[model samples]
Target: MNLTLKIWRQKDANAKGGIVTYQLGGVEPDMSFLEMLDVLNQDLIDKGEEPVVFDHDCREGICGTCSLQINGEPHGPDRLITTCQLHMRMFKDGDTIVIEPFRAKAFPVIKDLIVDRSSFERIQQAGGYVSVNTSGNTQDANAILVPKDKADTAFDAATCIGCGACVAACKNASAMLFTSAKVSQLALLPQGEVEADRRVLAMVEQMDKEGFGNCTNTGACEIECPKGISLENIARMNREYLRASTK
Candidate 1:
């Protein structure tokens, strides 16, 4: 199919960005959005022009690295999928697609469609892991019998890929949903109990320090999240934080 792509181009975080338009043809409907971008880049290279820069890894959607704002929506118009998982078939022939990077104060633009999401990594490093060591005296996971429902919820929360879509989707660019999901993933499991209080406090504090906005309960974060991370995780985190603050 023939199309027009209006993509953002910037030299770096300090560079002024604007939309640059290019026309292309023969985009297969089955091609993922990144593949379509690849075609466009190849065209640019063939013309001795610089290619657009975007972040992507494991295009299968597990890595959550291929993030783009398509037509004002994070990861395009598709639901429950990352930018790399979006297919070209979602568009029509002769369409004009607008693509930009996820915009947030914490996620400053690097170049073109790439943004520095290392803020997420910093937040994770703050308190997103279980500190327990099981190398030498490990007990079988099955020995600590977890309730099925709690286990399911924790697993659901763990699916968060830290894509920062939650922040991009929020009007205020809040990272509460992402931060809460990290907290809930640990809060529900007995293995994470030891660090529960400290984990929530540290993660939340770091999230704020990174310049992420507050959650006003708009719920856009969950709606745009590729993993469908629930608002309940935010609620659970609030409860956890309250309890932690008391201690």
Candidate 2:
């Protein structure tokens, strides 16, 4: 396939940025979006022009580092698919593709397409983990069996990959869904009960500190999440936070 890419270019977070257009040809339908960008970059290199900068790791869609706003959609127009999982065939020949980075104050641009997502790390460090000390023959799973329903819910919540697609897709740039997923995952598990109250409070506080907007139930985050995590987790987080803050 042949195409034109209008990609955002910026030297750094402090620099002025604009959309720069380039032509791409001979793209394979099966090639992942990042791979197609690689071909474009190679072409730019051959012409002695600065190549487009983007992020990608573990291109199997596990890392969630492949962030891109393709034609006004996060990770392109695919459902439950990360940018790395997006294929060139999604576009038509001679199409003009608009590519941009995930925009949010919390995610300052580092270069062309990469952003400083350490804010997410800081939020995770706030309370995203269980404080349990497991060693020397940890208790058998059967010793403390949580309800199967609760376990399943917790597992589903735990599937969140922290991709920031939720933020990218939200008009308000909210991280509530992402933070809530982490909160709900632990809040539902027995091992996470010890810090449940404090965990919700801390994570919510950190999320707010990171300048993420509040969730107004527009549901854009759930729609664009590559993991297909639901807005239900956000509701769970709200309930947990309310109960925790009261106590």
Candidate 3:
């Protein structure tokens, strides 16, 4: 199939950016979205032109690095999948696809379709870990029994891949969903109970410092999340924060 792609192009974070259009032909329906971009880049390179740059590590959707705003939706129109997992068959022949990077104050474009999502790392560092004794006498993790429901919920929350889609999909560019998922994963587990108050407090504070907007209950974040992380996590986080603050 032949297609038209209107992609964002920026030299760097400070550079002025705009959409550049190119015609891509012979796109196989089985090709993943990133593979389609790869074909486009190869054509440009063969013609002595600069290629469009995008972030991608693992193409199987495990890594959230392959992020793109396709036709105004994060990771395209597909549900529960990252850009790397999106297939070209989702589009029709002669379709004009608009591709852009995830936009947010905390996710400034580094170039082309790549944005600096290091803000997520900073938030995670603030308190997304459980302090554990890693000495030679470390206890087996399975020794601690967690309630089945709580364990399931925590596992669901832990599936967040930090793709910044929550921020991109929000009208306010809020990172609440992502932040809440991180908080919930640890807050629900006994291993993370000791620092629960401190973890919630620090993580929320760091999220604010990262310039992410507040959650307004619009629910866009959860809807756009590739992992389908629940809005319930946000409510849980709010409760955690309130309890932490009162203490």
lDDT of each: 0.93, 0.91, 0.95
Model 3, 40-141: lDDT tens digits are 999999999999999999898898888999999999999999999999999999999999999999998999999999999999999999988878899999
Single out the weakest 10-residue window by summed lDDT for candidate 1. 131-140
Off by over 4 Å in 2: 134-137
Question: How do all models score by TM-score?
Answer: 0.97, 0.97, 0.98
**Model 1 pairs whose backbones collide:** none
The model with the greatest TM-score is 3
Query: In candidate 1, residue 189 scores what lDDT?
Result: 98
Cα lDDT tens digits, model 1, 1-247, are: 9999999999888999899999999999999999999999998999999999999999988988888989998999999999999999999999999988999999999898999999898888999998756689877778888999999999999999988899989999999999999999989999999898999999999999999998999988999999999999999999999999998
Clashes of each: 0, 0, 0
Candidate 2 contains a number of clashing pairs equal to 0
The regions of model 1 sitting more than 4 angstroms off are: none
TM-score of 2: 0.97
Model 3: worst 10 consecutive residues (lDDT sum): 130-139
**lDDT for 173 (candidate 2):** 93
Q: Alpha-carbon error at 222 in model 2, in Å? A: 0.4
How high is the lDDT of residue 89 in model 1?
95
Query: How much does candidate 1 score in TM-score?
Result: 0.97
Better of 2 and 3 by lDDT: 3
